[model samples]
Target: MLTIKEIAERANVSRTTVSRVLNNSGYVSGEARERVMKVIEETGYVPSENAKSLRTKKTRVIGAILPKISTETSSRLVKGMDDILAKEGYQILLANSNLKPEKEIEYVRLLKSRHVDGIILSATNINSGLTGEIKRLNMPFVAVGQHIPELASVIFDDYQAARDMASLFIKKGHKRIAFIGVDEKDRAVGHCRKLGYVDAMEEHQLPIEEGWVQKGEFNMESGYHCMKAILEESKTMPTGLLAVTDRLAIGAMQYLKGQGLSVPKDMAVAGMGASELSRFITPSLTTIDFSVEDAGREAARLLLGYINGESYHEKPQVVHHRLLERESI
Candidate 1:
């Protein structure tokens, strides 16, 4: 119902002065600022964000692209990002990719088109094409969950996390260990974690059976079926199992329950991601706490620094993981 002109007139200040005060750009005397604030408060005036963007060249909004928004991991990360950004007068414009890799790239372009100040991509994987686009966009960007050498990112130590999980079982004297992982397309969660498991197994002189390793999608059903296949095909039963994610681990536990196999006593189990279900499941689960929320907060903080022309170190910021020893192992 009101415009900047009317507010300026009521405050007895030039419209240019009002604009400066509203944008917090040019210097305004304390008296002028107070008068403008009083008039704005009295009139219930709200500045047009579009007009302000045109004047200040800042939308003060960040775009966050995630693969699946409904998951516990994504939800926690978004909350952490929101917590930091909100304090700095910024908000998030979320774009969900529904776990499609191509959609991740598309959302980056779409967010740029919307004139977002920066983008925080919860990257599922990395290739030349995606990296090229990030470079081409030449925008303030940070990748979460996956590490790219060319861009800044906030990532978990997936390899170490997986290795540590395997070591937990090994230290408990598990010789034959089973593994359930997702497609290698997700390099961080699928490939690196598998490599870590393999590394730990080899380090402990444990022989890996051909049928002991199973690959599945990042879901519980996949875990359930994969565990079944392992049970059916493996010549000898595995003493321990390491799944790439908490969902997969939980599914494996369900399968074990159905099969009347006692966890830790019969087959120790562990997973990454530290999902809330890990703590409540029967016998609980040994897992690696990746501190996903911290990753999100750091991603937002780094992206904002880049957008604001501030220096930040640790291009691929590494968030440490903790081993949660539970009844599962």
Candidate 2:
């Protein structure tokens, strides 16, 4: 195993210089810092975890809990969080709750037991007593992709994104639209998206039948069943559909195809999320491009702030989203 001594020797610098550079001490010169870093990389010098722990009195570990990680949204969020945390010598202990609130609470307890410095959470909504949970544990935490009053969060502008997608359908002459939302408590996938649809319908002087809106589990299978049943029971066929997430849109599209119905020509479709799967699907999916990566980075920043006793005082941030128009809509 390579050591700091060997790295310092190879870099032709004192061990103190290498240590200073590794610690990001302000006194090191840029030239010396670059050389030490280069030598450290070239020699594959693995720093001792015990040494790091002793020096910092921290594990440099972050606990991350999410409802489900198989979705593209969560994957992108992890990528973004990694982009920042990796450079700071932090590793994340990731846990999946499989959409169960109890599992999330259990994971929080486990992370606290392990003495992790901070936590990042992604779920439908902030756990109602999440702040109290953290207070009991005496640990710092930040909510991501969801919001709670009086807590730090790295959230996006879900209302605006949902509003934009619905407004686009309305501007394109779609009146009588159906909205299939994801989680009931998901402000982004449910409340915000539905609110956006209603606002657009009212703006266009169209009647939004209460029957036209429903909820889905943000999965292909659930979307297929919901859309199929919705179409079967409808008084009239809708000209536009707004699926709350990309996976739901894909499943809904499959049902439409099975019925020999084509997109836009029959029922125009617009959905949220630009998951990689959307691009290859037949007719392509018209959707919103949200920044999960930005959410991840923001989450890390907030958690790091909390760990350092720094005040990250601000309401949840609403990152930007854009409409990605494709053949589906």
Candidate 3:
């Protein structure tokens, strides 16, 4: 372990000069900085983040709380955030809530306790408990995927994205359309998306059967069951289907295959979230490209703005989405 004093002595510079060069703060002559850098490179000296934080009150670490770490959406978001944060000499500390709302609040306090420079929450649902805790913390924060009131957020146009998909189906002459969604507690995917579908159908004067709508969890198995229920319970069969997630749509397709039905011929299907599986699946899947990575990058930039003393605003930065028309539809 080479101390700053030792490095300064070897470089023929004062310890203060070495400190200034290491911190990239204060002014140091180019010659003196070059000398210090040469000695540090020779000795492989790395500055202590703890010591730097104690002096500057910044850890250079951002805490990211995610709903689920294993999903592709989470990975893409992380990649985007890291792309920006790493360039600015910051690193991410990840906390996975495993889709538990209680864990989200718990991690907020835990991250605050750790004295993170800022927090980025990839929120699934914005509840009062989580929002209240965040407000009390009074730290630099940004929410992604869901908009939080009075806070900076990077959100997707979930409602319009769903509406566009339903319109596409209707344009292709799909009158009897079925919807598979998750719990309405997940307002963005479950509620807004379902509402969009219903509105599009109603606007076109299409009749919706009692069994045309089914609720499921965020998994393929749930989607399979939902599709099965729609088939068994609906008196009039639907010619088109829309699912809130690619996994659910894939599950529904699996059920349709088992029943000896062909896609786009027997039933045209579409899903949200342009996942990799959606591209490779048989006949491919028509889905929404939400550009999740872009959302992550935007969230990081917003948090950094707050951390850097930028003015706070309640307006959310909404990311754009596009529909990928594939063979399924």
Candidate 4:
């Protein structure tokens, strides 16, 4: 409806002066700028994003590709990213890859083609091929929640955090401990957490029994089903469990409860990554406090750095986290 020309005509100033006022640039006299902006507001003259983007080459939109976006843990990280970017007057162009590496790559290409200002990818891993594309496109991006050795990733020390939780269990007199993890992909936190369990078990000289470890998808159903299987296989059931994440722990706890086993009374459960329900659940989950918000903030920082032509070659950034001891453990 209302255009910059109309505002310029009404204010008797050049169109460039009206544009400067619209973008909040202070080059024009304050009185002129204020008059132009007031007329702009009254006239309901919203600038066209496409036209502005074409001229300035800034969409003010950040692209993001996430694995299983609806999941509790990953969604928290997404929310954190959205929160930080929104405050800076930027929007997120989101895509979901459903935990598939190939799909993630395809989405990466799409984001680049769309000319997103920056991208935040949470995926299986950044392959050697993907790194080459990153170099060629020179897009601003950072991987989140897991490690990518040669890429700028916003991740937690997942392995150490889980290991610390396992060590805590040992301190509480748990000798027979079980670990339920997800598949081992290079950048997946599930396997990293499982590695932590192994580290703790090896360091404490606890027997790494064949049947004590189980791997499954990180979901409530998988946790319940696999834990039930572990219960069935054990002659002397485990005293504690190191779940790959809070989602898995919640599932495992369900199975434990259905079998007439009480958490921390008959079994102790601890997991990596705290969730909202972790503190309010029946027994109150004992978990590692992996800070998604911190990772998100740092991811934004890395992207802005890349945008500014400051590249940190292959040096990974690690976010800090902690093991939270609660009633469940």
Candidate 5:
């Protein structure tokens, strides 16, 4: 419970000199800084974040709103963001929305109430309500995974990534391809990805059956059901399959195996989000490496720019993606 005045007295330096050494602001002589450091080390004195924030109007804490905290994608994104933010002496305060749109907006307001320096939203869905809430807050904000107009964002080319995977299937002589996706409310993963698959199929003059396209939730259980629906309903069986997520693809593969069908031999499968499980899974999953961690880093950088009063571009920052070909395909 020591104060700066006490430390300054012990160090035999003026309070202003101690302040300079602590904040790294202005300038302090080397000898004065050394003396301040010795006193701080001897007493294990820690600066009060509240006092510093009150003086500087900066908490040095960034609020991160994630769709789901337990997922690998979220973890990787957090790791990337931390890698950048920590070096800048910023800490992350996490808020999980659990894939609920209403919760996303609620968290925005809560983070603002907490006086966070900035917010990074790893969004699964974007709507007017959420965007309006963010705009109303008038704080430093960065959206990830989906583009928000007039707002800084770190996004992936979900459309092109899906197209690339579908094209790979076509190149491998797959004419009849099935698609497993989530609800279109998740525009990036559900809508754009489905569009990419459809466009690719049409471009190659491949016919798509109505039953071949199945919508499912963002979980393995949903994937299994969607695959079952596709198998039961499609008049003509698809030779290849593309899922919007690795979990969905893995679930479909699991269903296929239970039915005594072999992967690549019966139906080639591919998914997005090059998750670690994708690499270790049986037959290995062919997936897209969207560089999620890089997106997190980019989002952190963009948020920092906003926090630091830097001029920012209105256009979304797009992260590159690559297809990881594996035995499943």
Candidate 6:
């Protein structure tokens, strides 16, 4: 229950200096800032956010919407965002959609009603309904993991990552390559990644059979089921297989193990995301490192900039990725 007067007294600074340090607005001397921070920490002094919001018209709170919360990709991105926002005295109010597309749009309206300063959306798809709501909200927003036409986004180079994986498979002397991907509604992961894989095959003058391309959900079981379909339906068996996600690739590997096929010998395999389990799995799965955490950090940066009235002419910020070669490929 320490007041600003008591904090200023403890830190040996004027109340104005303490106010500057608390708001992170006017600059105070580095030493004085450190002293004030130390005193606040020691006393466990909590500021009145309600009074601050009434004065400044800023809640200093950001609403973050995620498609799913259980995955490592989501967790890493959240960590990166938290690292940046916490430094600026901002906190996140998370809204998890739990993989339901309808909930994504719903959460946008819900978060907007909460009067948060801004929103960082880990979007799965860019549809008219979602974009329309975002536009109507007229709030600062940054889309992560998916790109919308006019919205600012922080997204990975999904197409290049997928294409690079295909090229690696080709360089390793695997001609008949197969692809397991998600639905086309997801422009980044599903459509762009699949397009890149297809373009790579065509660049190598390798004809792709209809059966070699299988669609699956973003899960291990779907990858297993789609891979099984590829094996059973293809007139000529593929020597290389690339699944869009590590979970899918791992599932495909499981099917191969059940069939008693030797990996990288009888059939080579690779996946996109550098999931934690990818390296530890049998023989280690070759994959691409999309830097999911960096994307989150970038998203937080862009959204905060917008809220602070900084103009970025560029729409979406693109993140880089790397190809990780492992035993599987």
Q: List where candidate 2 sits over 4 angstroms from the true fold.
A: 1-47
Check candidate 6 and list the clashing pairs. Answer: none
lDDT of 6 by residue, 1-329 (tens): 88899999999999999999988879799999999999988888889999799979999999999888888988999999998999888999999988777899999999989999999999888889999999999999998988877878888889989999999999988899999999999999999999999999999999999799999998999988988999999999999999999999999999988999988788899998899999899889999999988998888888889999988535678899999999998
lDDT of 1 at 294: 91
Q: Write the per-residue lDDT of candidate 2 for residues 189-292, one digit (tens) a residue.
A: 67877787778778778887655776788688988987897797778788888988888888888899899999879988877889898888878999988888
Model 3 CA deviation exceeding 4 Å by range: none
TM-score of 4: 0.93
Candidate 1 regions with alpha-carbon error over 4 angstroms: 25-30, 310-314
Error of 3 at 179 (Å): 0.2
TM per model? 0.95, 0.87, 0.98, 0.93, 0.99, 0.91
Residue 10 error for model 2, in Å?
14
Error of 3 at 309 (Å): 0.9
- Best TM-score among the predictions, by candidate number: 5
Least lDDT summed over 10 consecutive residues: which range in candidate 2?
123-132
Instruction: Output the better candidate (2/3) by TM-score.
Output: 3
Backbone clashes, each candidate:
0, 0, 0, 0, 0, 0
**Candidate 3 backbone collisions, by pair:** none
Residue-level lDDT of model 4, residues 1-329, one tens digit each, is 77788889998899989888767665899788878878877877889999889877888889888887787766777778877788767898889889787887788789989888988887666677666676577677788865566568877887788788888999999999998888776545656777888889989898877677888786779888879878888777789998887888999999889889999899999876788889999899998888887888888778777766886647678888877888998
* Selected candidate, larger lDDT, 1 vs 5: 5
User: Quick one: ranking by TM-score, best first?
Assistant: 5, 3, 1, 4, 6, 2
lDDT per residue (tens digit) for residues 1-329 in model 1: 89888998999999989988887888999999999999989988888888878876999999999989999999999999998999988989999999887898899899999999999999888878888888899899999988888678888889989988898888888899999999898989989999999999999889999899999888998889999999999999999999999899989989998999988788888888889989998888888889888998999889989998975454688998899998888
What candidate 5 gets wrong by more than 4 Å, as runs, is none
lDDT of all the models against the reference?
A: 0.90, 0.82, 0.94, 0.81, 0.94, 0.91
Pairs with backbone N, CA or C atoms under 3 Å apart (clashes), candidate 1: none
